[model samples]
Target: MRVEGLKLTPVSSAGIEQNASEVASGSKNFGEFLTEALGEVNQLQNDSAKASFDLAAGKLQDVSQVTIAAEKANIAIQLTMQVRNKMIDAYQEVMRMQV
Candidate 1:
């Protein structure tokens, strides 16, 4: 399985620092951040779907790889749902507040 498109790279400190700077600088709004995060989750799901389909079609050799991809997509979706729930709770609490 020569996965040409799936190359894993080490997470460098510079990348983390840049992301932090962008958030701290307000270059990206909350909605923009949320949208990007959701887009990534969507991509994960799509990749997982492709892996699953390939597995069923016998195009994929390793079942473990498909399993891992599905799990990764599941976790991403779960995290996104949790974040959304928290945001909804915060909004409702703010609405209830007598300000």
Candidate 2:
């Protein structure tokens, strides 16, 4: 087996700052982001289901691939839930603060 060195790229702080500013300025639509995230979750679940069905029908040759797909979908769902919980908590905290 041949091993290849991994190539890594450095991220610039300027780009990150610019993105943060854009987000704060409402240049990007928050609803679009949420919609895209939900769409991704839906797609992952569909893929996992298809992989499982294909495996059960003997249409898939690799069991590991199907398992990986299912795991990916599960992780995505869990992460989405955690983000949602955090958002709710943040909102509540903001509401509790008085001007």
Candidate 3:
């Protein structure tokens, strides 16, 4: 059987390096990043709620859009919960470590 090479586009490293530098310089630390992420998740939940309200009030005709928004919010909440659980576990582990 003959095989052909699959073509792939080159990935950019400049943006990645810039983000790393920003994090390393403390201008945008972990707390700020976490806050921004949580804010985004909250926004998604608000959007989902609005979409649901609009659909119920007959302002929105697209049910799929409401479903998509709700699913996005649900996924974000699940991810945030997992991250919180992991952080708690890590904190506990550190507390248990001998100084």
Per-candidate TM equals 0.82, 0.73, 0.84
Worst 10 residues of 2 by lDDT: 27-36
lDDT for residue 27 in candidate 2, whole number 0-100: 82
Clashing pairs in 3: none
- Cα lDDT computed for each candidate against the true fold: 0.95, 0.95, 0.98
For 1-99, candidate 2 gives per-residue lDDT tens digits of: 999999999877998899899899998698889998999999999999999999999999999999999999999999999999999999999999999
Residue range 1-99, candidate 1, lDDT tens digits: 775787798877998899999989999998997899999999999999999999999999999999999999999999999998999999999999996
Model 3 lDDT per residue over 1-99, tens place: 999999999999999999889878879878989999999999999999999999999999999999999999999999999999999999999999998
Best by TM-score: 3
Ranking by TM-score: 3, 1, 2
lDDT (0-100) at residue 21 of candidate 2?
97
Residue 5's C-alpha lDDT in candidate 1? 81
- For all predictions, the C-alpha RMSD in Å is 8.8, 5.0, 2.3
